[model samples]
Target: MENKTKKNAVVLLSGGLDSATCLAIAKSQGFDCYCLSLDYHQRHIAELHAAKNVANVMGAAAHKTANLDLSLFGGSALTDDAIAVPESETAGIPITYVPARNTIMLSLALAWAEVLKSQDIFIGVNALDYSGYPDCRGEYVKAFQAMANLATKSAVEGHAITIHAPLIDMTKAQIVTLGTELGVDYAMTVSCYQADSHGEACGLCDSCRLRREGFAAAGLADPTRYKKHV
Candidate 1:
């Protein structure tokens, strides 16, 4: 039987492969997903467009883009024009790691969830086969969830907020397989760190490499548009 009283969930949709798959998972769990996209004034706006497309096609109850210029701080490669996004893998956390990005995005999502009286917030932060961001770790997510429950009025009144990181443990290939099974249109998602205005990937950045590898590992043809194609 179809769930008559669908619970609301706030999903942080980044228009990336992981986030798109996360949204699909939330929908599969019978939540009326409210997609949230952050316009942090990153190097590219292509992912924002992809986010909108994913939200619409995936049947999100609502989609909202929050505007905050993280570029003003200028710390990470994604936000700072001075820092170049590396095409090759490097040791330690890459410069592409935005400072406290996940924390900031989740805080925004938490606020929206409170207003909507939604107890769930979904973030697509993978650990395995990832770019080695500190915030994407399981412990960080758990800590944030604890803080959220303590800080929110809803949680104080007995409605505890749950932070869902469904993709945290899944490998890139596993995520690809799962998303495929869930009917996700991978082409609509953009995971490139240096995507062009038209959303064509550079096909050399860390993100593009991972995404391509994932599809290959899953024995699926990558549908991502590369700069070569343009």
Candidate 2:
């Protein structure tokens, strides 16, 4: 079978485990990756640094950071200092949901894909592990793909864009397993909403809870520095 997917792909990397895994997956699938990270003025800057390192280690074609001040529109915990990031996973949507974040990021990624004429864009969003973010849902991604195709001139002309979310259905443990198989060093990835200046993972945030649980469930030691894991 002639491979329809080109060697080039744009990956949305957040310097987190899921995104790093996505990058590894894309590369393993024979796609030369162009990693895109965003500096949207989130509380944690460590993930951005981690993204760069992961991209380098994973051998992405290029890793670029886009500066968009989502902090200017601060309402969510990630962007606002006044809002405390929840440490536990409560029922329903959490307060950490950044409004339209994936939407904005994916739109930018679509533009890049259209310019490069790339058929695939990989994101690491997962519904199971996700924290009640409306945009992270599988259905939303599909809708976004359809909308993107119709909105873009390239898709209108004939070349359709595919938004690929391989980690959408997988649990965190499964993701950890896949990343381990792919030779991804989990130590290189950071998943803390609030980290110290040196990027030490905060052991109390919801993100930390998820990461710790994933490692525990996978029966693997988390390489990240943490206070505790359960």
Backbone clash numbers for all candidates listed: 0, 0
**For residues 1-230, what per-residue lDDT tens digits would candidate 2 score against the true structure?**
22465467999999999999999888888887999999999997888999999999889899899999998999899999999988777788787888889998898888888877887899999999767788888999999999998899888899889999999999999999999998999998888989776678879888888888898999998898864553
Q: Tell me the lDDT of model 1 at 160.
A: 99
Candidate 2 local lDDT, residue 200: 85
Candidate 1 weakest lDDT stretch, 10 residues:
1-10
Instruction: Specify the poorest-scoring 10-residue window by lDDT in model 2.
Output: 1-10
lDDT of 1 by residue, 55-89 (tens): 99999999999999999898899999889999899
**What stretches of model 1 exceed 4 Å from their correct place?**
1-4
The collision pairs in model 2 are: none
> All candidates' TM-scores?
0.97, 0.95
Best by TM-score: 1
**Cα displacement (Å) at residue 23, model 1:** 0.4
Q: Positional deviation of 194 in candidate 2, in angstroms? A: 0.4
Pick the lDDT winner. 1
